[model samples]
Target: MLSTLGLGLLLAGRVGAFGSPTADAGRRGADDLVPARSLQEEVQEVAALKPITLRGGVLNAPPFAIDNGDGTYSGFQGDLLRRLSQFALEDDYNLTFVLSPSPTQYNEALNLVASDCNTTANPNPREECDRFDLIVGDYYCNADRSLRVDFSPTWLRTTMSAIKLAEFEGKGITTLTELTFAGGTACVPEGAYLSEVVKAKFPGASYNDCPDPEACIERLKSGVCQLYADDELALKYRALNDRSLEVTREQFNTQYIVWPLSEKMNPQHSRLLKKWMYKSVANATLDELSYDYFEVKFCPLGLSGPNCDQDCDPIHGLSDRDGRCICSSTKWTGADCSVEVEEDLNTYPPWEIAMCYSFFGINTLAVLVCASWIYWQRNTQQVKVWQPFFLYLVLLGCLVSSSSIIPAVQQSSEGNGNVPACMVFPWLFSVGFSITFGSLFAKIRRVYILFKAAVTMNRVTVTVKETFLICGILHLQLLEGLDSNHCRLALGVDDFCISAMLQDSQHRYQVFRVQVCGGRDDPKTGLFLRAAVIWMNDLFVICIIFGSLMHSVHFGPKKDVNIGDAVSEYARLEKESTTALKERKEKFVSRFSSIDSSAEPDGASVKRHSSGGGPADETIDVGSTKTTDVGSTRRLSAQISLASHPEKDEEDHVVCETIDDLFVEDDQVLK
Candidate 1:
């Protein structure tokens, strides 16, 4: 019975379900069976196999990779690993994370992955070696490390940043340069890549190595180190939790965070891991996980908030260290610096403007009236002597000067129009001053020339056209100086184009100080030039007044000394002498006629003799009287000729009886 049972079991094992072994082998070879299997059967075979598990190295760094101490992990890297794990599961793989046990620094983790632990030649193997298939901590990708191990695609791109105690906030250590120049000690984690960066970039900064990131942070807090350098995101997280800490606004040494995969890792697994990482980036899943851990989103420049949707006002806003908009200028306010602050404009009051306008109007009217009167009296001697053309120019200058009030008021009232108004104001006032002073100077100079000629007894003739030419040349010089110097000077006046809005001590309101033409802060050269021109004009006026006094003293009722004066005086004397001679001749002639007609010649002759001389003898006396009267008239005429014709020889005794005759002969020539 035992021999029969053994034979039956052998037969059952040899000829199993499907066919005999020899028959199955003849139908298909072992290599051919793999291809011959149905797709569903192959899937079932793969499902029956155990999942390919990968061990990932983790660190205690918060916000990047954190160990919960309960055999679970959570953080930016932690969340990223879990998300990658889901992709692995779909493709028949598993991810197992293990925190670094001893020497839990990022460099140690990288070293563990870079070391060969599976070879038999190794005497002792670290537990880290067994656990680390890849380092999932915040490992910076660099050329030195790339030679030691492989790296995944970049998970995060960030820069090195520093953190300090809040007490050192405004100690002029806000920038990396300042911190480096200060020669303060910095706490750098052991084996961190940032050590090389600090040594190379900021050689002046003295750095000490701490055992771990936490130790470095403790050193920074206790004042053992002035600053702690780390990845920007990690420092920002620390600053958010610890109010006593402040992250520097400046960042340095751009670095990329990546997973350092072991060189011995399966090529298939490495490819799948990289594939999923790229997918996560494409779908924004990596960014979403980053936000979940960091509680802040990275935004483009000049933007902030959770969603990065808020815009900072470009003109007046500045972003703070934490990405919030702040008003950069006192003239702006509100959340994003969009609203302008109300300013109390420093300007002339309405009453002042009105008063100025009133004065301008009155002066304008007076100038117009004077100009009109001069025009109407242009042919008169008083107006002709002063040159009516120049007189009108003086009045025109007055009107132009008064018109400057318009722009002055406009600039003060409407600050926006300051530049144009300021430009116009200087030109008007300067041109007017030049015109008026130039005209007055020409008139005074003409008088001075006449006085000089009289004193020197010389004949110097200055025509009206020549006087106008001199005045125009003076005015041109003044106006040219204004155009080249004063007009440009007006442009450079303090706050000429825009009002200076300054915040008061209380910080409630802004004070807007309007710029005026020729402000006190104008250049010294411009002021000096203006003063010099005014002084020259004033000197001319003083000289003119002094010359007039001297001229009156020199001439002093001596009309014959000047031929021009003698001509006028001789005309007056001649008229009076002629009338007196006529009256005397008439009396003599009437007396002679009465004596001839009278019977008693002796009585008549006595009467005539008593009256003056007799007739016959008295007539001879009358003839003598007539001859004496005629001789007296001729002598008076000779004196007039000598006085009037001083330009001719005295022997000629040629007289110009009237000023009109002299002027008619000369045809109104100016002297």
Candidate 2:
């Protein structure tokens, strides 16, 4: 105690003697605190020029990028982009954010920006395309994406996991093997990395696909799919919010997340981006971001439900509740719990709980609309042959919507896993798509023959067997359910265009696609293709049974009358629609040229650029989803134009006419 007092006295004496440390080294120390390169110098390296605009994509995933219903984006990623611009370019660059439209479009948007082939500003003929420099939002590094584009350093390392209701965690699901033994299906986004592990580790188990995490949870709770698999962070977030769901394994595996730069980004801009990433990591950007997104205090994982150790002050609420945090005051919620609410609920409201219901609502409305259209034209004769196709579409919509599974259309987004939608949607989605697109394709093929056929063949019949065969080909993910769509949400996807499993980092993040449908169609060529190979083994049996029988069967003057002339009229309309497709394609190819390393964005200029595409400061439109089906196949189809083939002369203009218009010519002939 004497020594401590003596030391304090000595420090006071020294202060009296020299006044302060500032007296001796104030000038030098202050200089030392500044970076070797002044902010001005850093700006100069890139050259202070007029602000340049860069195009990028915005994907809605909370804590990363949250869509603010009013046409703006909020959350960690949104903030980071602003910070990065300030830190990297000193706020000199303008960013034009476009909605990616799907999970897989994360990289597509990046590549499109890099390649300048999005057909946005400059029409086809690559040299004149509109250009975007780079994009960032829940992007993970993977081998497949590496081939197509370059990525900045890994930004975050993601841990993969599966989640179940808290009460069921005590069940036999302690391990993946047990999950398989239990025989309960796991739910995942279509094509997610976790699905690969599920298939290999839990080979005997079945899994279903959902459009996203919230949808997956809904499926899990409803018993459509009993388990949910995804990245540990997101799963952890859900588990914390809804005490009902618990993360089975928080650290299943980790993968590096990164912000991808355009492959063709200017060298200066690339360097600047790298510098920004380095500085962000070194200068507390990530630290602050983590605190904001992951440090919520409302009954966090360890303190949830029965495990809670504290209670809110009685002044805030009438009483304290177990397993949930009760704030002492409305002004501050998590604060009284010794933690702070992640963000202001008013400024950043939660994602619409009933957004997923759009899958059902929209589809149901579509069914009603189509049915009504058919009813009105029931006696018109023009609608007779079209009824079957439209009916098929209505059935397809029901399956995709899975209204039966997602019963509580307005259910809160929190703890949505295990709803019946997960299980039922997958199988129905597969069957629905197979029947929908398959029928459309087949019918179009028949019309195509009649219109363009060199010779008038006698009679033709497309029996259910052929439809079944065509439908079978599209059912590559049938066994797994609708996982392909979910797989896309977890980027760096592999074969079947599936995301990479943590099993092998080297092979992680591979997504195989053959561009079609006016260059937007992404086909399942990798992992799902392997499933295709296995499915092919069933081919011989089908051929032997159906081939002979089909050959022996003949039709009694199949549906259409004077098919040749009817098809002729349809052919001309198709050709005109083909022209529309050509114009559309010519319009989307883009090359981001206005961007420069030293570009300084004026706030007004950035606002101007973003405003032109939409009615807001940020081009904030939700990417059209791959139906309610998991990423398994919808990403490949969601935004793909009906022009399956891009050629000027011949393209699949399947949707050029409504069912009514499609059959009008045929009806004319029959009548």
Candidate 3:
């Protein structure tokens, strides 16, 4: 089945171009473009001494060989064969192109090549064509052919893919193993060497001997065969024009395309053909032809790549002539790409293991340093050198605490229950010290205010020292009490003990005393806890000392006057001013009363006495006016003059002085 398809592809080559041309033009195997020395000069030199006649297949090989439709032949391979023939004949008889049309209906290319009468698809030894003078084309010179005819060191490299009708896709048939397992039948051209390979690989696979590759494809289309297997190039040739077929990625094998000649051929002719074919294999002409037909492929082996010869030899699926292994792609290196690296974390090298430390350490430090610097510049007011240092310490706490959290996370990931005591203690110390110091720094002024009010400078000095000493003692207290049954702050029994000692008044001092009596490391908690406690206690002392200093500066009143007395003085002055105004009004009223009494009674006395209680409630003066109501005084001025005038009869009223006189006693007094 495969043979018929391959034959059909071969016959259809001249109809249309297959695959892409320009796109794949340069994709010939790795060596396809490598320059090679010319064998022409050497062949010509040899030709001077010998006459050689080299005959090859006359039929067209498409891109390789063509019939030319006349008595002669031309094509890629045909041209190459003729050039080689000329070089081999060198000053000899005419080198002829013989027509070796497929003899058997199968037209197995090898059989044609093997026939004594002609050379065909390739040279072979089975048909007794071993006596041929010379031959070249796209031929697979197998081991048998190799013994019958010498081949150039480097042969044509092919990348093979399985091509099948699309209808057979997804049938669970891929490898020969799969076909044999599925109890499926296969078809191939009779006498093709691939038949022997398939039979060996899949002993149970049933196969039909088709006449040619095209027949096998026809049988496959007709459901007479489950599949046909052949080289990717031939299958691609058939699939190019037919939309009903497709090619797969799986490869059956890789074979070399080489030349063959009868062992009897003159050594000079054989050598010339060998050298020309090798050079041609790397030439541009073959590459151009290869692009239009087959999928250009390379022998990955023998290069420095993982699959190269030093890794895996192309001829065998195993290591090559060197001790170095051509590693399979399954192994990828992360370093220089030489070592076989493992995937498991446990197997990772020390440097890789340390990667996590670098990541966490550097990153944590960067954040802490930057944050601390920003915070210090913005919020700290004292401008003390220790301020940044303090901030640095706090940042250190944050970093340590953060690092401590990693162990827990890692433990969770690893599913390990053991908690590291060192990590736990330091994390706790950072937390406590951070909170304690932060609060102290925030309230420093408040502490100073309280302290300076209660102590003198000299006493303040003594108190501060005592405070620090007590702070140190308390810090020591905590350290020694760390592991005590009633003092430790751990999670289990030790935690209960720490809590009891710290919280129970009766046990607190005793806990400290006990620690003082005991030696260092006598069931002590840890150094970090001790250090953290010391820091916190010192912070407490600073707060207290600052408080005492503030108290000494502002304690009691610096003068006799109190803040309240100044307020009282303001109130007294305001009250006195209010009283003075009342007294003046009373004295003025008395004087006015005495004057009215001195005026005596008159004819107007009744009218005056009835209306005049004192001065008029409101006195109006020309250009000015003064109006007074009992206990209240108001003054107004008008510029208009007040002069007596003749009254109108309708509006005028009589005015009597007292009861008889209306003349003013003193106008000056009125003014």
Maximum-TM-score candidate: 1
Local accuracy by lDDT, each model: 0.63, 0.52, 0.47
Q: lDDT by residue for model 2 over 1-671, one digit each (tens)? A: 43333233333433453345555565566556533446466345444433334445565666677778765577777776656555533444422234333335343444454444545542344532234456656766777667656788666667777777777656656545567778768887765545665576667888787766678888888878767877766776666568887777545547777776666666876776677777788988888777656645444433434445545444443222355655555555652355545543221122322343444455555456545655654643334444355344534534442443243322224443434543453455456556556655666665555455423324555555665566567666466643455544555645743334453444444635545566543222222332233223223322342233233333334344444466556666767766766653342222112112213222212112343566333222223433222213121123323213323222123233222342353344334
In model 3, which runs have C-alpha deviations exceeding 4 angstroms?
1-53, 58-76, 82-131, 135-137, 152-155, 159-161, 167-175, 296-671
Model 1 residue 191 lDDT score: 76
Candidate 1 structure lDDT:
0.63
Query: lDDT of candidate 3?
Result: 0.47
Best by lDDT: 1
**Ranking by lDDT, best first?**
1, 2, 3
TM-score pick, better of 1 and 2: 1
User: Model 2 — TM-score against the truth?
Assistant: 0.36
Which lDDT tens digits does candidate 1 get at residues 1-671?
Answer: 43333233323432342365567778987676623556576446445533455666666778886778875677787667666655554554544344443347666667777744434533336654666678767888888788878999998888998888887767746666776888878888777778778768888888889877788988877878888888888988887777788888878788888888887788987898899899789989878876666554344666755556788787788666466777888899887788998885655556655666665676666666566666665655444445667667766666676676666556444544355675776777777777777777887787777665655456777777876686578667755554344332354556633443332333343435645577464333443344334334433443453344335445445332343674345555656766776775574456445434544212122222223543222121111111112223221111221222222232222222332343343332211
Instruction: Mark the 10 consecutive residues where model 1 has the least summed lDDT.
Output: 619-628
Report the C-alpha displacement of residue 64, candidate 3, in angstroms.
Answer: 5.4
What are the runs in model 2 whose C-alpha is more than 4 Å off? 1-50, 89-132, 172-174, 197-201, 296-671
Measured with C-alpha atoms, the lDDT of residue 4 in candidate 2 is 39
* Candidate that beats the other on lDDT, 2 or 3, i.e. the better one: 2
